[model samples]
Target: MVIPIFLPHLGCRDRCTYCHQGYITDVSGEDIKARIDAAFIHRAAPCDVGLFGGNIFGIEPAVLEKMFSFFEPYRDWVRAFRLSTKPVPLRDETIYLLKENKTDIIELGIPTFNDAILAGLNRAHTGQDLFDAYHRLQEEGFSVALQFMVGLPGENENDIENIIRNMVRLKPVYIRIYPLVVLKDTPLYTLYRTGQFRPTAFDDVLDCACRIYANAVKNGISVANVGLTDNELVRDMVAGGHYHPAYGFLVQSRIFIRAVEIVLKHLGYPKDITIILHNADIPLLIGHKKQNIMKFSRMGVTVKWVPSGNNRGHFEVRSQKGSAAGSVQDIYDQ
Candidate 1:
């Protein structure tokens, strides 16, 4: 379980082209303490406490220290202390302070590595800032996650490939991908209005995101997230772009389709085939609205998806003439 503590725009120095944090309701420090207290007092299981909504390090050291102190009494019950921040200069002392407070992971919102794209987004940090912060945090023995976005303004397929290559080189403990969404009162929205920037088509974005997800997972890096969260504020502010509550499912469904296609291609489109997958992946395999099943049907290929209580990613395909069992990598490699 994870308990999120939203410090909405609490330490923002500048706004990004997609953020509208000012419209979000604020949660006071007192309110945070009360929530934490209630979580521990009422809940029995261990839970991670996340400090989200803005850069935690950007807050004043004194106030941060005070906030960290609030978790001291419940330290034993806290499974993890995770926080997200922008790619900014981080002092060594601040790293040490986080360690002293038992912080577990630091997620950096790096978005994209392309300098031109970063500039277009008005992300006030250089690519070097990301490398510096990543190295510094790792050197301090803290797990770090590099957060990336899929459809930032000016980003393309080549940009996505480059970002994946760079992220693999960094080898962060976790990676998150947020497909861009044009929100109200942001620079991106202005650009959209002027026809200066166009959001990537949702299907195109889903395909691109699936490529990144497959490559990243194959590299042994955890793709912690695939899309943005849906909420009242997001719904109210979203003007366009890939904003879907079930975005992760959509990406996985695409992946499932690809994996199945690869297998079928290799097997010479047998008359009938049974694809055995883990039970948990049933919905993804069938796809949203049974799209995959229907697609196979339209191709005149008899496809059956069977669930087995086995390891995820481990699957088997059986046809009248042949049978094979392998993981996604096996099929993808073909």
Candidate 2:
């Protein structure tokens, strides 16, 4: 479990077009210690304490020292510490400081690989900067996690594809996929008002996110998150774009349905089949409203889901007539 501390927009010199961090974050500067103390008091030892939301590394040196000092009391009990930062140059001293504080993970926001898109969003960093920071973090033995947002201004299918391919090559231990949301008072909202830009259609972004998620899974990279955290603040501020409360679950259900269809195709339209899946995948396979199962029923397919404790990805498709064949990985391999 993670105990997250939000810094909001703290080290971001320039705001991205879609960002409204001030509205999204719940914790403020005045209550940072109170929130931290409350979270730490309830959390048990050996859990991750994450510094989320802003560019932590970009914080002033004195303030960074103060923040680290705050965590000093919990150092003996905290299993690992993680922080999110922008994809910018890092000093050797920063690495030393993080290492000294026992920070195990560093997450970088690399939204997209296209330099043009990056500039349009005013991210103030380039793809090369991301690569440099990633390698430097790894060289210091820090586990890296990458964060990407889909449906950004001036992005296309090819742009997203390039990002996934490049990210796979980077091979970060974890990744996050956030679909673009046009928040109130952001530059992107102005663009929407002026008819200069439009957010990607919900279906299109969903399709793109599924592809990214599937590729990450196949490459052995864990997708830590697939959507923004839903809250009243976000709901009130949302101007437009893909903003589902259960967005990640929707994508997972889509992937599950696709996997089932692929297995059915391979089985030559078997009348009765038992799907052996991991115990944890029940919610995804069953879907938000049992949509996946309902889809199969509509297709005139008889489906039975059997839970398996050890199955992770190589699921067994067992025919009622005593034939078992095809795994989830087989669909991708073909």
Candidate 3:
């Protein structure tokens, strides 16, 4: 488990076009100490601590040192430290401080490798910066995770390919995929209001996210998360872009549906079939709102599912004519 301490926009020099951390997180930078204290109160087990919601590397070494000092008293309860930030301004001093403070993982937010898009988002860093930071962090014996965004302004299929290529090459410890969401009062919101930045089709964005996620899993990289966590504040602030409360579920269900479609095709589109899968994956197979079931109905295939002790992601489809067993991994392998 990880205890999150949100320092929203604390170390950021300038807000990105889509950032409005105040709406995404309730805790302010000023509440760091109090938040930390509250989180550790009545703690019964050591847990990892996550410093989130700011460009941690952008903070001065002195400020970072002091900020880490807040956790000194509860250091015994912290198994390790992790933080997320933009992958630039990674000063050697900051690196040393992070290592000295027992920070084991650094999650770099690389929205896209497209230079033009990066500049348009006011990220103030390029793809080269991420490569530099990633290499440096790895050399320092730090495990790295990546956070990627989809459906950004100016993003296209090429950009998505770039993301997959880099992710496969770097092979981070894990990854989180987020579809961009325009928040209220942000620069991106202004663009949306003026009709200058219309988001891509929702299904298109979801499909692209599935491709990224599938690539990550196929490459043996764990997907730490997919999509943003829904909250009242975020729900209230969303102006446009791909935002959904069950966004992650939608991605997983899409992958399941795709895998089933491939298996059915290989079986010559059997009219009726029963899928035996691990009980844990029933939700994924059924999908949100039973959409997958309805989709199968439209395709002239009758679907039935049975729970089994079969390993997760493993499914067997049976029909009168034939039987085939496959896993989600089959989707990427083909």
Candidate 4:
């Protein structure tokens, strides 16, 4: 469940180049304080209260302390409290504050790890800032998450690799990848208007998503999210940046296809192929929208995503060349 609160959405000491404050935080004055004090503390909502919107701890330190104090009593009642903040908020003191408040999880909107891209995006911090914050939070025993964005202006495959490299160094408990998304009334929109910015292509972003997810899995890291949340209003408001309501699903489906491609290259199938996948990821490998299935069919691969009781997110691809199908033997040979 999502529990919303009003604060600086980006929550930096100052707004960055692509900040849209109003759209993110629609609360004002007493309403904001009241919600933080009441809804998350006194009032009964969902068990999970997300101290969300912008930077959760980005207010004045005093205000931050007050907000923390307000929720102290109810900390145990709630199963978990997720604090969303800027990467800099992972400083020594900030981690202590979160711990004191009994925060169960912490997430940073890192955006990108490439220093040049981050500077161009006006992220107000460097890749080191993320690493420092990440390490500090970990030493303090907090569940840490690092968020990265792809397909921003000045970002290419190298920039993407940089993100992966830096993030792997951090080894965050949760990793979220957001494709660059443009919104109205932001610096990015202005750049787009002047033709200085071009949104990443949908297919390109999908390919990147597959690599990123695969890398996380290879490293035994949990990819908490792959793309922006699916919402029609958000999609409609997206003026630029690899924005698609179905993009996340497509990315997941592509991951399955990528893995299947690897399997096929090894197995050498020349006919219709049936791929059975682990139950947990069946929806993703086949796609929630049957996107992967269609893509597979178009490529002359017939994938039948079935439950694999013995495995999760693992699949077997069967190449049907009638009775003469020789690919099955390749699986045994491997």
Give me the runs in candidate 1 sitting further than 4 Å from their true place. Answer: 22-41, 330-334
Please give, for residues 1-334, the per-residue lDDT of candidate 1 as tens digits.
7888777776676777888775444556786677667767876677888888887767767767877787878888788789999867586666777888778889999888788888778778878788988888888888999888887777777788877788779898988888898888988899998998888778888877887787777888898888878788788888898999888888888787777777777777787989888998778778888988888889888878788875887677899868766565542221
TM of each candidate vs. truth: 0.91, 0.88, 0.96, 0.83
Better of 2 and 3 by TM-score: 3
Whole-model lDDT, model 3: 0.91
* CA lDDT, candidate 2, residue 128: 91
Model 3, C-alpha of 328: deviation from truth (Å):
0.9
Where does the lowest 10-residue lDDT sum fall in candidate 3? 23-32
Give the candidate number with the greatest TM-score: 3
Candidate 2 ranges with C-alpha deviation above 4 Å: 23-31, 42-46, 270-273, 308-310, 318-324, 331-334
User: Model 2: which ten-residue window has the lowest total lDDT?
Assistant: 325-334
Evaluate all candidate structures by whole-model CA lDDT and list the values in order: 0.80, 0.80, 0.91, 0.67
Better of 2 and 4 by TM-score: 2
Number of the top-ranking candidate, with lDDT as the measure: 3
Q: Model 3, range 1-334, lDDT digits (tens) per residue?
A: 9999888887788779999988434334447778889989989999999999999998878888888888988989999999999997989999999999899999999999999999999999999999999999999999999999999988988999999999999999999999999999999999999999999999999988998988888899999999888899999999889999999999999999899888899999999999999998999998999999999999999988899999988899999769999788777431
Give per-residue CA lDDT, model 4, range 1-334, as digits (tens).
6565546563556566665655644344455566666764555654766776577546656556766666556665566668777776444455566676667778878877778878888777787887777776777777888777777777788777776776666677878887777878788889988998877677787677667766776666788877767766566667877777766667666666666666776666545666565566767766756777787778777655446553655666666542121111122110
**What lDDT does candidate 1 reach at residue 113?**
79
Model 4 segments beyond 4 Å from truth?
A: 1-6, 21-29, 37-46, 72-76, 89-93, 279-282, 302-310, 320-334
Tell how far residue 187 is off in model 1, in angstroms.
2.3
